[model samples]
Target: MDLTLGAVLRRGLLAGLAAGVAAALVALFVVEPVIRDALVVEEARAAAEPAGAHEEELVTRTTQVIGGMLAAVVVALCLAVVLAVVFAAVRHRLPGGTDFGRLGALAAYGFVTVALLPGVKYPANPPAVGDPDTVTTRTLQYFSLIAAAIAVTWLAFAVRNALRRRDWPAPRAVVVSTIAAVTGYVLLLVLWPANPDPIPADIASLLWRFRLASLAELAALWGTLGLTMGLLLTTRRTPATPATAAT
Candidate 1:
């Protein structure tokens, strides 16, 4: 099987779509209800406040659930595609050469960089969890952290490459890169402004559960997609299949 870029992309897209289906199923059956329950609590809190609160429902609950499922499927597929490209691009640079173990390690790295790193700073919240006035600011800060994480990771790669060119040992290169990335990450967290809106004590548990479920959502999507892509890419398949191409 030729491991051309197009062939890798085809395999990635297929795997990503499969992952999307799995993620959507989990979100629909498990995560969505937890979110809905949190929303209910939020709504009750609002209702108990001053009269004439905004009560219009432009989007119905049925519609929200359906739309959420669809969005999850689409987002999962997209993330899978990106992960596939990243995997293919970086596999050769790493010590292992297209081995399953290396592939799994890369997947874990992706989750840490793409999901967990930024997630720790700007944890996911229920619909009404944060202050409505600070939505834009909060969103900007969250994405800024994501961008910083990505940039730092790239810089670490540059550090490793530079070290490798200078006859540095593999372990030394890895250690330096890890230190640089971690140091940069910590500095960014310190410099970034924190979210001041405090979570109410009563609903803190529910919020925690919602955030956990949110992280689990990404973990499931990426884990499934990465593993599936790795397996499909490593295994032999017919040339007629998208997993392969013309020799």
Candidate 2:
């Protein structure tokens, strides 16, 4: 029943592996095709350029594809480690009917804070869409918004906890917290800088598909990570001796 760091981390790593695989599958089957379609636009633009004007390709598509898959695994592993550490620290405080529910809630929250909010503000774009000149500006805006979103969410949680400590009704506390969080998010959305790059008509049409595919990949990673972590922690295992198990 001891929620030891080692035990939790071990489960987390395995969950991360499963999540990476699931995300990679989504990336390969869903996102990649949309990327390929966008790349066609890039290629056409390049072919239209005067000879020696287009940038030279340093990496082949095959290498990029493989590398992208590897990157997904690496990113998933990092996120899983963070999840494990956070769970170990705050699992008892997390609201849920069961451990599975707690972990699931955490995973869903992680997705919104880490992926959804930032993505909504600055949606993903395939190659040939964004302007190279504005990359730095866009990157800064994207990360800044993510940081702000996380801060807002954390503050909301703290407010809810404070209310609970004051003996406020749980439902009232949650409702108040939710309203505050939504207001904060709306303010952030209105204040944050918009993407500087103008999407070409062709790229704009493809943007919806690319962003949806990206969301699918992200959801797959977080959802699988949660599900796998829960199974690892909760699935009953038979012991030779009567070793006690903890939920």
Best by lDDT: 2
Q: Which candidate number would show the highest TM-score if scored against the true structure?
A: 2
**Per-model TM values vs. the true structure:** 0.86, 0.92
Which runs in model 1 stand beyond 4 Å of their true positions? 99-102, 167-172, 238-247
8 in model 1: Cα distance from truth in Å?
1.0
Q: Candidate 1 — which pairs collide?
A: none
Task: Note each model's CA RMSD in angstroms.
Answer: 4.0, 2.5
Q: Give lDDT tens digits, candidate 1, residues 1-247.
A: 3457677788788878887888888888778888889888878888898988856889998899889888988997788778778867876665443546556766776777778877788778888778988888888888888887788877877788789889898789879988997898888788888876776788878878888888888888878887888788778465675643222
RMSD of 2: 2.5
lDDT of candidate 2 at residue 128, scale 0 to 100: 80
